[model samples]
Target: MNPYSVRTLWISDLHLGNKDCKAGFLLDFLNKHDAETIILVGDIVDFYSMKSSHHWPESHSQVLSLLMQRAHNGTRLIYIPGNHDAVIRQYLKFNFGHVEVRASHIHETLTGKKIIAVHGDEFDSAVCHKRLTAIAGDVGYDLLLFLNRWWSRARQRMGFPYWSLASYIKSKVASANVAIQRFENAAIQYARRKGAHAIVCGHIHHPDMKVLGDELYLNDGDWIENCTALLEQHDGTIQLIRWTERCELLAESYAFASLQPDAVSEKKDEAA
Candidate 1:
């Protein structure tokens, strides 16, 4: 297949320093696609996990190196710090090896639509106001991801395709659904406040492309679980793609529907 090129690519929740991070898959995805602009929406590195366990593997290092190489190759790179790697927030506005760090950015699409790019943690009440609860939740989430890794390996042994155990649990859990709804509402409202036509973010780990009234809400999902991303075409159309399904879908000559102005709540829901 020929190399695929895009106008913009948004990805996040890599949690690179964590044991469960799927760095090999991410590296493959990056190698397959090239973009004019790349947005690291947040939680690209699991600093909290690294601080606790100091588990930085060669795979994680390779991921970082590849990103820097891309930047050096003239791709405009933007890094927005998320809660897990929030320490980088201190160096906001600094440029490191062609990558610009920022709290948020306003991206103008080819069609003149203004999209607000942020990590989306600021709108998460648990992360913002309930510190203890948030930390507890993070611990639980880590355990879930650990289990998911084992579960996925077992499935692979059985010759089954990749599936997200954590994502399935999140969808079935009532509280998780409520939290996701709240996060989505908060993100849309924040975009409105910023006077942006749309908002692209990653934190909830739910990939979606929805039109709420007149504005759009997009999430790039995560590398740790869903292995998904949000891509903007040269014509300003956006697509939420799952890397795990790419091979099968490409065999069928799949083409995603373009973003429509009047469309309401279209989503490519990923496992949490």
Candidate 2:
């Protein structure tokens, strides 16, 4: 639980203005772990609705304070805005209170591989050009969140741990899976177009790390579902890590296994 043991951390989809942000769990994760750099992938705040109703809670403030402390202590912080907070796009190239915000960025890993870091909303057909579709998706998403919240509450009362109903359905529903697959393909293709060897994104709320052809695709699942993050080790070895239920490092596809060992070794060397 020592915060000082980690190197780099990337997380997304906190939805701070939403009541379902899970700030407590996030605070626990932040307090328990330390990283040299922290990447806030996007949608850290639910800006879409913040204009209509102000809903920043105490826990939300606490999380912000935690990040501020880390940044003050020299942790490099990078933020890429998501669709929900698209307003930040205007200030993407600026710094906000110790956190650097960007629309998207290409990050070079320690192993010299280039990775495209973005929120992935641009790839979703329903999200990109159509406001109506986006609103519909939001409506559906809100219903799911409502169900998930009470469902988890009931589960807890029954001695079961919290679980994401939306995520469970996302993994099983054919249409949802297909959409996610398409999004993944688009992201990977975009990475290729951008001359990147890997792509790390959020906004779909699904946590996954997969390899397709010569590229790697990673999604830092949202707190609403997988409660996960994608981490880039010092040597450029990427990992999909979860934060709930004791914190787990999930298995990731080794599409480019040849590139991994060297990265891990380099990380060790850097640490040493």
Each candidate structure's TM-score, on Cα atoms with residue i matched to residue i, is 0.87, 0.87
Off by over 4 Å in 2: 126-136, 253-272
Q: List clashing residue pairs in candidate 1.
A: 167-271, 167-272
lDDT of 1 at 56: 86
Best by TM-score: 1
Q: Candidate 2 residues 30-86, lDDT tens each? A: 887678888888898888768878889899999888888888888989989998888
Top lDDT model: 1
| TM accuracy, model 2 | 0.87
lDDT for residue 99 in candidate 2, whole number 0-100: 83
lDDT of 1 at 48: 79
Total clashing pairs in model 1: 2
**Pairs clashing in candidate 2?**
3-33, 3-34
Residue 252 lDDT, candidate 2, scale 0-100: 45
Model 2, global lDDT: 0.74
lDDT (CA) per prediction: 0.78, 0.74
